[model samples]
Target: MKKTPNFKMFMFLMVVFVNTSYSQDVVYSAIFKNVNKTAENLKHHLNTSGDTLYLESKFDLNRIEIIGTDGLKTFAINNITKDIRVPLNSLPMGDYTFAVVQTEGRDDTYIYTKTIVFKISRLLPIDMDISRGITPLNASIYLAGGTIPILDLAENKIITDFPAAMDLASMEDNKPVHLDYTSMESLVALQEKENLDAKHLRTKKIDNILERNKPAYSKAYNITDIRSGNQNIQSRADYRRNNLRPNGLPYD
Candidate 1:
């Protein structure tokens, strides 16, 4: 009636195995880029609040660390696939500087950092046209150092895409039209028709440096800007026609 020694050993082994299985750690990951500039406000949806953030370097696996306002904290992750996505839910609502070492085994490796300013608050109505350019309507829209342009309506309730400049040869067919600001039906329809043309792709391919350093990073493709050479002439024509729609008419 004495307890067997083999049974006691088996129970201890089972406890150790169960403890090891339950102590699984979560990994953090993100990729880095050498591109000169990127979109400032890259917002992401959050599932819950008060999440811990871990920063993993795409170039160096050993450089993974926890980034906080107080200082750096060491952490590990499974992989880093794209731009560094660290949770800022626990941090105060304000500007923050995220800094990390770019390479491992080298102390002189570049210190990469980005400044992000964000606020957790209600949204506001934005005037897209005024954000993009200035036209003959006595209002300004374009700003210095801005690559993209925005066009605003007469009432300024909504904004439109930059007007396409028409050539003199197309002057006969060109006229301004008012469109329903509630929906972007015309732009969407036009995009489906004239999108992905050979001309546009050819222009974009030549202007961007996507095929550099073959065999090293052969699969890597980079795009800075897309230049089609032709202005938005067709878009201007569509706008002019739509603007012609009267307050109550079908196509007015």
Candidate 2:
């Protein structure tokens, strides 16, 4: 008597064969080889003058395209040399992919494409009011450091020079404030008025603050959580308990 073939084993083998065939079919473009080789020789340097992005390429480029991470093309140029300056004052801060394509060979069949990814960041200084209970005590202490030292917790190194903070106490209440070193002096002055100990002033690493506070910020500002009926009800209850007027009415 012949034994029946193992159906499960046969099915598994068939699946493996199909997957192998599919993987073989996924071939990279021919241009990618030249693109990779040229990319190895190319070097990119990025600098910012006000809102303009100055991109310097070491190797000559046939075409350069700036594509947003979302696959939207923001800028492009053809037959450009090494130095290219792009105005990005209006563009939002985000990651973008730069594609540099070049063609070589007498027949012009050789195509090469290279991609560089980068992010744009902006530092905007705003004035903020420091109301009691509005800002955390530790954060206030950090602000008091005036030229606060930002430590990289992972590397355990100070990144940059201490920035001077200005006292904008006369500004409108509840405005956003960008605290620098001078703010530390203001904080010290406030402490003196309250007769608080100078020893209470402390500095914290930026990484530590971000790591500790990220979860709270995420929870407080999560859109999905805010939209949930249960979360809204819970938030309302918390508000009623935490905010009460002199007449015993909950602050709306």
Candidate 3:
């Protein structure tokens, strides 16, 4: 296995644009915005405004830390690869800094870390849009909680039936384009308690222009079906229940 390189050698950042004039920062110590070789440090300038916050990396990203301006850690979550989940709705409107940590496979061996910056324009209190009559940027809207909000620059009111509050417009000469960073990769169940799926098909009604024009790219999906799950001991008693926690590796 290839070991991670030293972070000191790659500790500078250059600005990058994903699909717009301005993109969400990734400060990944590279000049080009698109680099795919896993051997090298990989990161993307992701500008998004969806509720399902995630990234485009070949690394096994496992943790996320939401930080404040004074370098105070507000929240930290391990097992982030389960879904690069960041609870955007629960947070109030403000600038937030993210520390996305990637580890070597399933272990605690650290590989690389990067910073992502975004600003939440307006938050409609808790369960009600008590102030929709007032607009922050004239294009502001309210969300009903549950969906993630990455970089909300939406001109229309936000859709409450969906899972993410993605930045869904590209209207201005300098406005950010839809970069498809808001990945709906079958990881999240769109139907939840707060969603209004039973009342109407508001979700299905959403028209993602990029999704429609995009060709069904010929791509194959693969993963280690069976992994030697986390365990310190491997006695004979453990093998009796070796279903998910197979004694050996996925492949010999």
RMSD to true structure for each model, in Å = 33.9, 26.1, 32.9
Kindly list the per-residue Cα lDDT of model 3 for residues 1-252, writing each as its tens digit: 121243222221111131132222211112112233442443433223222343444555544555544454533333333223332445454344455555545436644554433222222232232333321221113433444323322221223245556676666657765534344433244545336665446645554555687655321222423334452334444434443335655322
- In model 1, the Cα lDDT at residue 106 comes to 42
- Estimate, for each residue in 1-252, the C-alpha lDDT of model 1 and write its tens digit: 232475346445644643453233211111222223332223222212212232233353322333435564443322332223333323443222233333323446654443332212111112322344312122121221122211111222212233555556676566676678545787887676677576688877876756553434221122333435652233434555555444655443
- Per-candidate TM-score against the hidden true structure: 0.18, 0.28, 0.28
Error of 3 at 225 (Å): 99
Worst 10 residues of 1 by lDDT: 117-126
Q: Tell me the lDDT of candidate 2.
A: 0.41
C-alpha local distance difference test of each model: 0.34, 0.41, 0.36
Candidate 3 Cα outliers beyond 4 Å, as residue runs: 1-52, 69-71, 74-76, 80-82, 105-130, 133-252
Instruction: Indicate whether candidate 2 or candidate 3 has the larger TM-score.
Output: 3
List where candidate 1 sits over 4 angstroms from the true fold: 1-58, 61-69, 78-84, 104-252
Backbone clashes for every candidate come to: 18, 13, 12
Ranking by lDDT: 2, 3, 1
Candidate 3 yields a Cα-based lDDT of 0.36
- lDDT of candidate 3 at residue 135, scale 0 to 100: 19
Better of 2 and 3 by lDDT: 2
